[model samples]
Target chain A: MNNPASKRKPYQRELPVDWWLKHAFYTKYMIREGTSIAITIYSCILAWGLLRLSQGPEAWQGWLDALQHPIAILFHIIALGLALYHTVTWFDLAPKAADIWLKGKKLDDKFIVIGHYAGFVLASLAALIIITL
Target chain B: MSHTDSTKLKRSHEPVFWGLFGAGGMLTAFLTPVMILITGILVPLAIISPEALSYERVHGFATSWYGAAILLVLIALPLWHTLHRIFHGLHDIGVKRGRDWQQVICYGAAFAVSVFVFTLLLQML
Candidate 1:
């Protein structure tokens, strides 16, 4: 008699290598993956802030001075761009990731995505106002 | 009879899995803003306040029980969320073999990094 375990079928059948690449959601996933890398790099800036604090006033001042340089500003701008992209994609995917159920009805993904974006914009505006004041 | 029954069971459960994944994504979206607000306020305050900018000062704050708790939550949650997202992404991209092993690695790395960061924060405090 044949071994039943060995005779069992594989969990997944073979498919084309490019199958994922052809799907739209796969493209979104790639974009999000890239954004995650940018976010990781951006974290280094915060690490630097922590390092400067630990080093005393002179070191902290030096870090601030370097931050004022044009090249540094440019790097920051690029990082900001990456961060913004990450934020947008993250919010966009949020609805797809979590289905909001109220009572027996599921809330629409678009509503959730849009609401998050609105909150982001309002909070950013508030922060800007507070900082400028 | 066996093959047909198995296929039917798999089809029935697929929707449930999709629904759960969708719910997780939405919750992350909603929480992202609060995270931004905290970081935005804290970073600028840390920058502008000379005392807060000092290692000694920041360390003082971080060493406090409150600071340690905040640091722990801030670092851990985002990393965990991102790791989950990355796992799903890898699976989506057809990296199906040894997926369990991949998940273990992702979670382990996130935990290790969070611990390292937390340790650094504590040391400074």
Candidate 2:
């Protein structure tokens, strides 16, 4: 008699390496999520900046000057694109992740999305004021 | 079938990790773009003067209490977010072996870097 385990046929479906490429929504989601890499790079660069800062003026100046290099400029451009994508995607998805209800009714998704953008604008203005001060 | 299903599920303490990831992602979503706008695009393009981020000024800011806090949050939490994404992305791309090790390596790097950043930030303060 065959063992019961042997009698059972397991279903195996291989997940594609580029699974996100299979559909539009998935591709968008993956790209949005993938922007974190650029964010991570910026974090590392900032850490280096902090180290240079700790070493005093000359070191920090050198680090700042490095940012002016063509290569650095190019990297920054890439980072900018990624950052924009991440920001937009975050606002777009906030409603889905945050289940907000009011007066025993589900809140509108648009309000959630708009609220994110509005808050972002306010924060950006605040940061600008602080930086410029 | 029920027994097999039950046996397969080892209760995962994912909420804690996910909480960190959410916080990091939220922070990144708002601040990072503005950062890029100022430092990367505006300054580099000379739309905002390069002197805007001069060594003396930035260093002074970094050594301040609030600045240290901001820098620590900006630098550290997002690393956790990125590593978490990469960890899950690996699984999404069908990394079939040693899931435990993958998680450890990913989150371990985030943890180590966060500690390192925290220490460095305190030194600045």
Candidate 3:
């Protein structure tokens, strides 16, 4: 057991810490992944809001009032930008993952992308309208 | 190594998490921006009336079954996608220790929050 055959160290090259910083593609990919942090925090904020809501009106209203702060507004703006970036990247990859055949012809990727944008627009409009109603 | 092993392969739970990741990614792509715009931007800026998100109105929405479902999906589903990304992102950034624990903590956080939100919604209803 002390001399296991697979225990030998392999000659693996050390990667530079900032390897992702060296290329535009890698940088964008890192930023895309980084959006998860913002989204996670935003979700936590909402979760906190729900908790406050559960406590009663004063607590809930306090939560709302807190959102009006400058820092919260800035964070939201940043989060919104990141979310849009996520949307663009996600839709770009969508067509590659989905395959549809129609009348002995495969659907074009452009159409799939366009359809996604249309759905996005419509969904946003629907949410906005619903909230205000 | 013994050659007398069972022929069947051990199953991985990847597909379940992958499905959640896909669904969450789709939802985040389509709806998250507008949600932030409304909740964080318009409402706080008073471009939309505060009453639009007033506690009374929101509470009314939360008490309904459909509303509870929407809230659950919106709050919980995205964590699956984000945490999945975060788990992999840690690898990208070179924190290479304890991969198994990293995965556990990432997904565990998502699952914990999901249950937290679910319980809150259930209680409210």
Candidate 4:
């Protein structure tokens, strides 16, 4: 059995089912990423809204009414929570993705985060103005 | 390693996925909560009337090229982001099955929906 061709390597163990559960950080990380479910749901709802647009006013109104229903409202409430989680986590992780070098020194992470918040405020204000007009 | 050896090292195609994920992440951070606020809270509470988001007005917006562009980016980017997360998440969660299949199913669905939205919006124009 000790032949050169039959030299066996040690079997590599697969990751445990509860690998993430073992660490608080990993669990939080998973939760953050998993919130994408909310985004997916919102996307589907919006996509369906687009389809309803093609149909007629009645269809689109029906879609709106559906959203106003208790169940849809409840789902949206949960989606809001998940959406907020994603927003916070995304902001937290933004600095790692961006590597802007200003005047030979690395730009600070706090500034990157602050810049994102500032941009969000500006964009949201602009959108609100447009929508209200 | 020499330049030639480094050149021979094939890079992962992950950066493309990560790029979309990053863009989507940024978009999500900016827009998702606001959207939920507008749709979920404001309209429902009648603080912002349903008329603001009525079928006619929204459809009118969609018919415009600019409106279509905004709508497209809003929906499409988050989708790629979500699918990208789900695809990687499967591995993180110790799902030992097919990674390729997972990737195709995740991003493929996002791509499919995006096309569907584009085609439907185009028809309205």
Candidate 5:
């Protein structure tokens, strides 16, 4: 039997799978997802370094030698790009996850975003100077 | 407008929720460039720096208070935000019933990761 209900639009229409991918949120989500994969791979590289270190100086040097290969360096660059995307997106979400209120007024999200970026810059600079010298 | 129309209007426009979502998006946009700069400059430097190649040096950087702070913020916020987006996405895709389960998994994973990272940081310290 043909049901009128089947032809009528449902009260709650489910969005297509590609709907999420079309929005800005989806772009951000894809970036984050990519970063997660990159992070996992980078972590394994680190774990390998730890193992090599535990082995001895010669083994550690060998690990370093492997890292110096062109393909390895390329992977590192890609991983860094993904990681940076992840970091920035994270700070962007900070103000949303926790709201800031001062004297019964809510602070702007831009302020929080700028503040975190400033902090990160200053901190990185401090680390760079310390390490360089 | 009729009373029914007014009610519909009021329900459609939730200022607080939109404000929060917009604020979050804006905040992320502002921070994106600086993060790019930091990673861009540092990763290259890291490649050249012999010390950067060392596990001790890399781990030391990772485990430092500043490093720990960066990692914590970097991991936490995006994960939380993405999870939030994912929840809405799921709802949009007709998965309306299991939102509580989604919240549990999202928040629970966030908490677990935070604890794990903090524990590692403490150990390093």
Candidate 6:
């Protein structure tokens, strides 16, 4: 018995390593995706902080003190920019995910986008206030 | 052969991960900037006072169930979103090898940290 299933060849498109850099549109898409790197790093830092917190006060303080380093500050600044970029891109695509209807007509996408922005602003303010207080 | 065919549908696990991705993305979009602003930039700059994040206060907060929940969510949930993107981003950047292992490592990292944080919180409580 002979099996014929092993003879298939598929066409794969040639994608350049710098393909995204070739166009503004693809560049923006990659940048939006790249924001994940910063977010992932930030999550690790927070996880590390939690571990430190689980240790004694001294360990926790050490983690806090490290945040004051210049490199940490610089990383945070860049991460902030990328995170904001993620926010913009996410919100721009929010309407498709949220298909709310008002009466018989579909709700305006602008309204949903604006509502997300409003919610984001309020949540940020609430966090700041809670932490400071 | 037709009579042996079952009508039951095969379930895909994609929705569970996708749900986590959506929730994490929403949280990251809404809260991550302000978090970075407070912990990374403002407090470290001493503009918001480092005492605001003093060890005593943070410890007290983490000791509470609500606070522990918040901490776990903030620290771990976004990993689901970010790592999902990073996994896909690898493909976009032309990483064509080990696709299965790529997914495992990506989601595995997120799960490991989540359990780590949860255990720490449980110990604290």
Candidate 5 lDDT, tens digit per residue, A1-133?
Answer: 1365576765655567677578898767766655544554443454455455555567867877776676776776786676667668778777887699999999989998889778767765665565555
* Higher-ranked by lDDT: 2 or 5: 2
Per-prediction fnat values? 0.08, 0.58, 0.92, 0.72, 0.03, 0.88
Give me the runs in candidate 5 sitting further than 4 Å from their true place.
Answer: A1-24, B1-47, B51-125
Flag the better candidate by DockQ, 3 or 6: 3
Q: In the order shown, what is each candidate's alpha-carbon RMSD?
A: 7.5, 4.6, 2.9, 3.7, 9.1, 3.1
Clashes of 4: 0
Per-candidate chain B TM? 0.57, 0.82, 0.94, 0.89, 0.57, 0.93
Query: Which is superior by DockQ, 2 or 6?
Result: 6
lDDT of 4 by residue, B1-125 (tens): 56676478788988998888878877888988878777766676677878888877898899999999989998788998999998888888777577788888998998999899989878888
> Model 1 chain B — which ten-residue stretch has the worst lDDT?
B33-42
For B1-125, candidate 6 gives per-residue lDDT tens digits of: 23434765678888999999999999999999999999999998888978899888999999999999999999999999999999999999999988889999999999999999999999999
- lDDT scores in order: 0.59, 0.83, 0.95, 0.84, 0.58, 0.94
lDDT of model 4, residue B18:
86
Candidate 5 DockQ category? incorrect
lDDT of 4 by residue, A2-111 (tens): 35587788686778878878889999998897898878988999898889878999988888888888888888888888988887787787889788999999999999
Sorted by DockQ, highest first, which candidate order results?
A: 3, 6, 4, 2, 1, 5
Please state the CAPRI-style docking class of candidate 4. medium
Error of model 2, residue A130, in angstroms: 2.0
Cα lDDT tens digits, model 1, B1-125, are 56665467544644543443354334334443333333333343344343334445556666788877765554454555566667776776678778878878866766676676677777766
Each model's total of backbone clashes: 11, 0, 0, 0, 1, 0
DockQ of 3: 0.89
- Candidate 3 DockQ category? high
Task: Return the TM-scores of chain A for each candidate in numbered order.
Answer: 0.69, 0.83, 0.93, 0.82, 0.77, 0.92
Q: Candidates' TM-scores?
A: 0.57, 0.86, 0.95, 0.88, 0.51, 0.94
Q: Model 2 chain B, poorest ten-residue lDDT window? A: B1-10
Q: Flag regions of model 2 displaced more than 4 Å.
A: A1-11, B1-12
